[model samples]
Target: MAITKRGLVLGAAALTVSTAAIAGTGLHFFKGQALLQSDDSKQQVADADKDTSLQPMSMLSLQSFFNQSPKELVDEVWQIIDRTYVDGTFNQVDWKKVRNEYLKRPYKSNDEAYKAIREMVKKIGDPYTRFMDPQEFRNMKIDTSGELTGVGIQLAADEKTKKLTVIAPIEDSPAFTAGILSKDIILKIDGKSTEGMDVNKAVTLIRGPVGTPVKLTILRGTNQIDYAIKRARIEIHAVKSSEVQSPQGKIGYIRLVQFSANAPTDMQKAIKKLEDQQVAGYILDLRGNPGGLLYTSVDIARMWLSKGTIVSTKSRTGEQDREQANGRSLTNKPLVVLVDGGSASASEILSGALQDNRRAALIGTKTFGKGLVQSVRQVGKDSGLAVTIAKYYTPNERDINKNGITPDVEVKLTEAQGKALVANRDKVGTLEDPQFAKAVEVLGERIQAFRNQAPRAETKR
Candidate 1:
């Protein structure tokens, strides 16, 4: 719809002219109606005064405003946040004042508008809420779909040292093939140092067109090694399943790398195949999973949970959404979940839900606490914003945000042991893996206890 005179003149949205508009139009007003410097603006204003339709260039179409003034882009993002932002205080930044301040700036280019948006997002004091440029937006969508064109290494900054660290390499991707183990501290991408670099910036630096080589300077322990790894199109099979023979019985082992859209389907197939085989127990390994779609996690949660709340999202505005299982679980086999520092977001949600509901025994170290929910919204023709919309809680109403869910049985791996296991990925779910070994032990104990109680309960009844 075309922006009418009232919409532009009455400050429905305060928009300013970009440098491109100033270069084209001789005289143009930015704050109010975009009046031309010539007598045409006067005539148009006079026409409005005479009670006729005020037809200025801005009244042509809103698209024209979008093309000429990047300030509209600013307002476009501003309006979305202003309307739907869960945080009433906008993370304690005066959101109203921020809009006016940014709108007042003469945006020289779309980049300038994007910069303003970035700074504005930063003022919200949320690291998760960020502006994604066109390329980043595209990559983010691809990432959630279990595909991406990059080195295929998930990265995060150390909470204490704040150094850019590798979470884990995507299985069979370029980084994984290059032997880039988990917990490898990235010193630099190409030649630039990663000091004070966030994950977003590091990602921008590391990723490029497929087949292109991106050199990474990695600090593993005290040794500094340079890896010239070529980027590739990574298609991640997030769920992998196998049957392991153990003392307890045949174990259905499933490793979930990330909660991509296909996770639920894949998980169902895996569980069904294992159930048909009559596996005594199941082991869900969510180690090094960076997480994906929130709904995908909920869907997977339903695959295991027969009933009870799986997760709940509560916005700052008190808008709450709760998900519950509907008795569609594939099997009721004794279950154990494996987690570590890399298990984050959806991983935490799934693990926390299972742990809280007593559906599974968690056997691993603490999880990587990232509980904020983000909504990916398009800003304009291109570019997007990932704004934090809510914080999720487990079935027990535990907010596992920064403080991750502690496992029922802590099987912590030391730095060396963790590095070795990551180096030899084949042993990840086997008895050789200390964490997996502990999971087997815990599952055996639980299975024995259940067996011990079965006869006594039956006789009493």
Candidate 2:
């Protein structure tokens, strides 16, 4: 359908252009007479408008607006816009410009819509209000545990050089075995320079069919090194456990990467394995974990806490509420959860739940408090809005948004001090960041105290 007079008028007004009478143009617009006469067409337009309007605006009492007078709704919105966002920022935001530039054009397919939304959201310049379509949102739904095929390497963008640099290579992965080392700058991938390349693009370039070849040009120290790296299927373990018969007897250490689809199953398996080894306690490492799935966090927290609300969400409706976690728990052992500024979203949920329930002591630095829960709703074909639908409150009713969760025992990262690991030598793992040492110290002390009370063990044969 061609642009309707109304659309053109709106578009032109947004573009600040003079409008002309565009009657009988046979554009997509339904003329006033035609619109009122055709019941089916009227219903179609109404349905579309209703769909957009009926969506409960985040933290806004949208349901109440339905029964409210226009003056009331407008007043409420104005007040909300004023109170939440100062300086009339909403008025300054060109939503019509966004709609015209991004959504006005009819999409050919969902892929087109998805691409458009991504582009639009990128243009918004707010990293928080992202567009995560159904598929992408589904991926964000849980922290599953499983192995994924990709070249295994820890990458970081150099602050000064702005080049993709290898922080470390995963053991036994193609990058490690292929001689990629720390501080090796990746200049290009398959002839494309890594200069100004984002992590997503680099990841896309790095990930391909297993056994396929990817050529990389790197700067090793001052010398440039080119290597033909054959991409092999690399397995990423979300959960790894090590049993140590410490001074306090048996202690189990479980490191969790991200919350993935298989995380619960893998965590259950880890727990059973630790139980079989008769582990006395556990050290759960959540440091550097960028949260994945909400369910995964809740599931992991449920394993340790058997009690009140794990997390609660308040929707757009002041009355509408959702909560999760039943009072079923699997483990009641002495627990220490490690956290850092990198630990976000789902990680925050798990840590907060554990802390709120008194099930575990949080060690390390403060967590990355991203308490807002996003719900992806399909707004257009192949495009969805990953809108911040609600805020999650911990079991203790604390909402950790900008203010992150502080550890019970605040330990900095400088003590672990791997000199080669420090990308920024000046601020490299400063005492302000030495999280690992704190976690180890906290867990180790707890284990030692427990050991002092335990019966002396006989020498093993």
Candidate 3:
């Protein structure tokens, strides 16, 4: 939808404003980024006049603007996607017509607006680009912190089956305590069927204030189970570290669950502490890590790599932005990364960077293979839109969207063993976990080879 108020620039639409002209035009956006207009909304002003329902008056002065309407929300979502979707082609659909068609429709309620937003997003055929209601948006913000009030679990929609699937449950949270395994299909929430529910809607139904109760109906293989879990302030320690003695020497064991804003700082502390203990090498566990912030992943990648390209993002216009290490690595010791099918997004970024640069050996199954980058923007007064703004690639220029990164040594787990680890997360980094054991073995070889090259290493040298 072409919304022009004296040719006022909205998101980065292809109007006519230079980068300097958009210096101070914004409507109090998130983290202070001025979302601009893009070519998706580059329709002529005459198209806006054809709506008939909307007068020739500027969009800022519309009666609907003073009193919020569902139509207003619909146009806001339309504008954000038009400006930011990675594919300027809008997946080959006429972006301007889609916007014009949606803005022309009448929406009576917020639900109607949300429904229209979902329908409009479906045209792109990218599942990562979706809309979130007000409550769902707030919950997403809470997840950035290391704590939240909910039965901690990450959910996603299975692409092929379209089922509401569990990516992974946060360790020791209410959901994990109730034995929620990864890949379990959530059939219902509090007796409400989730046949066609989106992840945001399910998250809104599942999250509540601390000490509240919620029921979840899950489908695991051939059995349907019900779990009544109480909501609480689930503390998510993104980085968990300890020193484990191996034949190679003391090893730093660090498990990163989510790449939140605090991940870099926490990881630095772990690495520094392990270095003080003179650990020979490291084991970074990214198992069941549904990734968080994109920039956070880059920062962590730099901590392990003294010099290498971390990751790169290519926009619709073929402009690629690369993040590289600036020689500030925390340690230069050999490293082994643990990954599985749950390792996705930012997780893949860090692991892929390390693998591509030969900085670390990966031991586990293939990664989850989600390389798309989404930008979240505030829509209307309460809702938010997560639009896929770009697609990322590994340092080797490999696009791992559906095809995951193969581990240097694949340590596949049996269904029973996988379920057992899900049942008891405390046993994750121990020898009982087969992947960790393999990582230690592989790391021992690296360390031994590393020692052989030293001047007798002068012992600890």
The candidate scoring highest on lDDT is 3
TM-score between model 3 and native:
0.83
Q: What is the lDDT of candidate 1?
A: 0.68
Arrange candidates by lDDT, highest first: which order? 3, 1, 2
Global lDDT scores for all candidate models? 0.68, 0.53, 0.72
Question: What's the residue-level lDDT of 240 in candidate 2?
Answer: 75
The alpha-carbon deviation from the true structure for residue 175 of candidate 1, after best TM-score superposition, in angstroms, is 2.4
Q: How would you encode candidate 1's per-residue C-alpha lDDT over 1-461 as one tens digit per residue? A: 11222101221211211000000011111123322122122323311111111112234234643454678877777766765466888867888999889999998798898778878776766655667676554443331335567777767556567687776667778888787866789998889998966456677777777789989999988999999999887777879999999898898999998665467778889999998998888899998776755656777888888989988877776736687888978777789999987787778889999999999999888987777765544456556565556678898889887788999988878878866775787888888899999999998887777667665545564
Candidate 1 error regions (>4 Å): 1-68, 143-145, 156-165, 177-187, 195-199, 218-225, 455-461
What tens digits encode model 3's per-residue C-alpha lDDT throughout 1-461? 11212121122211110000000011111111223222123332212112111113235424444466788788777776776678889889998998898998888899999888899888877666778776565554332336556787777777667788777777778888888877788999999999977777777788777788889999999999999999887677889999999998899999998775567788889999999999999999998887765666777898899998988878787745687998989898999999988787788989999999999999999987777766555566656666676778999999988787899999999988887887777878989999999999999999998888767435674
Quote each prediction's TM-score.
0.80, 0.57, 0.83
Model 2 regions more than 4 Å off: 1-97, 100-116, 128-145, 152-203, 211-230, 315-325, 377-385, 414-416, 419-441, 444-461
- Backbone clash tally (model 2): 15
